[model samples]
Target chain A: MRRIESCFQRLADQKRKALIPFVTAGDPVKEVTVPLMHAMVDAGADIIELGVPFSDPMADGPVIQLACERALAHNTSTRDILDMVKTFRETNADTPVVLMGYLNPVEVMGYEAFAKAAAQAGVDGVLLVDLPPEEALDVKPLMDAQGLDMIFLVAPTTSDARIKLIGQAGSGYLYYVSLKGVTGSATLNVDEVASRVETIRNLAQLPIGVGFGIKDAESAQAVSRVADGVVVGSALVNQIAENKDTPNAINDAVGGILSAMRNAMDQ
Target chain B: MSERPDFSAFPDARGHFGQFGGSFVSETLMGALDELTAMYARLKDDPQFRADFDYDLAHYVGRPSPLYLAERWSKQLGGAKIWLKREDLNHTGAHKVNNTIGQALLAKHMGKPRVIAETGAGQHGVATATVAARLGLTCQVYMGAEDVERQKLNVYRMKLLGAEVIPVTSGSRTLKDAMNEAMRDWVTNVDDTFYIIGTVAGPHPYPQLVRDFQCIIGREAREQSLKQAGQLPDALVACVGGGSNAIGLFHPFLNDEGVAMYGVEAAGDGIETGRHAAPLSAGRPGVLHGNRTYLMEDDNGQIIETHSVSAGLDYPGVGPEHSWLKDIGRVNYVAADDQEALSAFRELTQVEGIMPALESAHALAYARKLAPTMSPDQNIVVNLSGRGDKDILTVAAIDGIEF
Candidate 1:
């Protein structure tokens, strides 16, 4: 099984929802990322979705956009990100690592090469925010061949027909964007999300991970009730942004939020 | 490689223009774009929509703008006769209004009460604001903070026309950033908001619909060329930022085997300087702003900041159709540096008593170079996409003149 699948399977067996924390690959600094990933796992993250910083992250709000800018300011290349993933694999191989960002960076590094490099670097899944299943026809097979799951987003407005198509095309899980807006823009109403998640569940067989508007332990716990996983991005990135000046405080600050959310989710 | 594609059959139902121009937006936007595509497909041929669009174009936009022969300017160039397609004469003073008018009508039909747009120089903002005011729709325009500062008059114009001009301060703080912010807004408010994409870029139906709406320019230019010049012009020239005007003037002529086309991109210092926006001439294909197109990006595929004297032409990517046309060897993609465009701006102002927008000046610059090489009997139609009134401040600043 793919690392992402096995990670979910392990979580399911324990009757626990997955805690996925997303961080831009080289935010604040390059050296902070690998240790941060390890810290996130130690803090009770099931899967780490490391964002490959892009110049234009349209779907993201100000918090994560700034995170991308911080990462890109250091000239973090795709190779550097893959290297970070490889280094993380040295100490821990069990936690599934999913690279999340826009599509152009992977497009620059040819899809075949990106798939091979990502898989070899112990990365298990990719969630390109811009590349929907319609446009992923050519790239999906290449990723699947490399034992990499091509994860897709199911938005609040996504139709049942598209959910079926995405569920069949996707592997690992379907990330349900719990709001209509960009990440970190709005507050989530759990009931609305619950209804949407229920519809998605009826249409698609894959595990559903809910993100966007998940800001705190309460929100994460609320999402974990209906979701197989809770994907927290802007909130953790906001922690990194606030603690960026004190580099030493970043892992603890980010991990602290995830730990609290994990503890809350367990209850 | 085997055989050329039928130009008419392009952007197949999936919106791919020969591996370019696919709807590469997020899942949140896919359904919205699909809805838009389906709506455009239905209304593009509907006679009532067409009649309404035509009624507005004729009375409000001043349609069939004259294709004036620049006799004195052509005499000075000493080669091909130059015919100016007077898009600059349109209401709101640019070709951008053509697309805005069409989109506003669509907004009314779709029952969308709010309209939004991203503007580089604020021409599109002002145009959107103008239409929104006329239609009694709430309009919000996202413009880069730098642009809002630079284009103070246009910001004022939009506000006066009842638009909420929001300054986007993200990502290079320019046109691309404004577009990013606008996309975020659209995804958030997809139900009631109609996004009036200002150019021939963006996902699927936008490129198709914007092109369809603006095709009137080429259609009129074609008819005018025959009526005034006694035959179709030997060549067509238009500036390409996001390539709305160029595509507008070129789409109708795509099958004219006898006519050649040139799409001039803005070269800030020059393409070799790596600071320009001439993606077709220098950059490679990549995805940005929901479409696959040639983009000015670093080796890591991060979009690089572009520079151009013309704010409207400073975008890092060209329209995807232009990319397809470039690959198919249909439209000849060229570049004009800031210096050449400035000189052309001065020459047109002095010679023809016409002040072309700096964006249009890029096309004029190329025409100046090409006109001198051709025989006087042959003619060239240049799309004067907008007037230089908005750019007077930019010109004054360049000339070290203080207001």
Candidate 2:
């Protein structure tokens, strides 16, 4: 919680919007993850949302879905990704790494055991897309005990009442999916998101990060104007997909996109 | 949870059948599930809604489909009297229509203009399409590409009923993949869409509501068993895919201590071969789609590919209620290998002229094995959940006979 809070606080003091980029940990291969994290940090990412590959990423679009498929095709396990996080922490301990994915893999590992492993691996937080708030009571306390901020989604369909509950329950920052559809969906109604963010701000004191349709630098800058953080996922994942065959180029390709988004967010 | 459960009340307010079920879905879908759950709680008991549901079942979907005495087949084994709960006679040729008609009515009551569903053998697709056509609602059904090839007639049937059949090519290209696509559609078009999940699976209210809608099967069979036979049967047997038919037939019997219930899952080769859709038989409790249930997953929690000759019974995950029942010892979940189910499919058709879907044949196979072990005075009712007309093409191909 302190890592995320301090990162956002630092960004706020600098009068700069936080740039959050997401990548599947084992996408392309397991060897690229640590270097990619370092590359992303060098490219001006304030925090990293590391996606854990799940067989079924129900809410993600095709780009991220294929990313997960590629990762799984290489047979990436939760322990392998935790090892990646541990390796990343050897040189950098400041950047908050939020592990994101579905709940089944975590459930398979058992909640408390997975939380302990994650905390020991230098992991900072978790955002399970499919673990709705209604059922989150099962594992939230376990994650909390490990000092992992349990991030939750605040979508357009969520009521003011739900927003309040999610606000109280969530710790790191609330992810506001900018549209009703999945990540690669083209429709990003900035006006509607601004209005929803306004309402979300009123209901919660947490910093709001908007994603899922913020594809390019332009969309990132537009979203950054309205929210505390701008998150770009599918666009960067799509870039990785293009350069997957050349593993050596993946970090530069992914980091290049994040650099452009970070530049745009600052502008 | 270790003690015998209070079977009457399940899927508690947040949709939990003990630790097996809960609303495990995206935030975008939470409000929609909440809305549907509240609506179902209100309408499940409303007299007008029940009347509409009953009237449609009686006139439109063909209710009280017979508790048939398969005496011809029973005498061959000559150990016990075997009965078939004839859900295959229902309109659209399966027990799937019972839940579809009920959900269609619920969709109408909710004032939703569009409805969507996913199907494997296309029984649920055709049933959903049939109701949508009758009610003047736009409908779409997602089917795996492999199923679209094998169950061509049902695909045509669904399309003829005006449902746009979308062929899903992802994952294993089977029912599980189709469900994933359908869930994606429902999540995207949630505002005006009512997803008529064909089974007692998925997130909240779905597992509870679909079971409630189909429980008429067991309720009617319970009454008919008393009327046709002298008393309740010694055992209730049903095939389980996502476990709708099994749960429908099992839920009403849960509290009856005298009634022993068995859920038959498809063991494609054998349990030892590790190629089957028998989650309860071989899987561990894990989350999939939107519910935590027994799933065919690997040690690392990746859902494994499942195989069954029957497309409908090919799902890797069974329903949450079935998981709960299996855990509580209220239901015995066993598996029938492909060859056993195929042999039973042929035997029932030849002796009783009752062609069973391959999915239902799994139950028939188990019943055939169990029937010979009991006395003639005893009885067992196997849920013949669907017609085999959809499987004719696949059967002919297997027999080296071209249609």
Per-candidate chain B TM: 0.99, 0.98
Residues B39-156 of candidate 2 have per-residue lDDT tens digits of 9999999999999999999999778899999998999998889999999999989999999999999999999999999999899999999999999999999999999998889988
Q: In candidate 2, what are the lDDT values of residues A16-125, reduced to their tens digit?
A: 98899999989988888899999999999988999998887778878888998999998999989999999999999899999999988888899999999999999888
Candidate 2 segments exceeding 4 Å error: B1-4
Docking level of model 1 = high
Q: After superposition, how far is residue A66 of candidate 1 from its true place, in Å?
A: 0.5
Q: Tell me the tens digit of each residue's lDDT in model 1 across A1-267.
A: 788888788889999999999999899899999999999999999999999999999999999999999999999988999999999999997999999999999999999999999899989999999999988999999998999999999998898899999999999999999999998888899999999999999999899999988989999999999999999999999989998999899989998999999999999
| Model 2 chain A weakest lDDT span, ten residues long | A178-187
lDDT, model 2, position B347? 98
* Full-model lDDT for every candidate: 0.94, 0.91
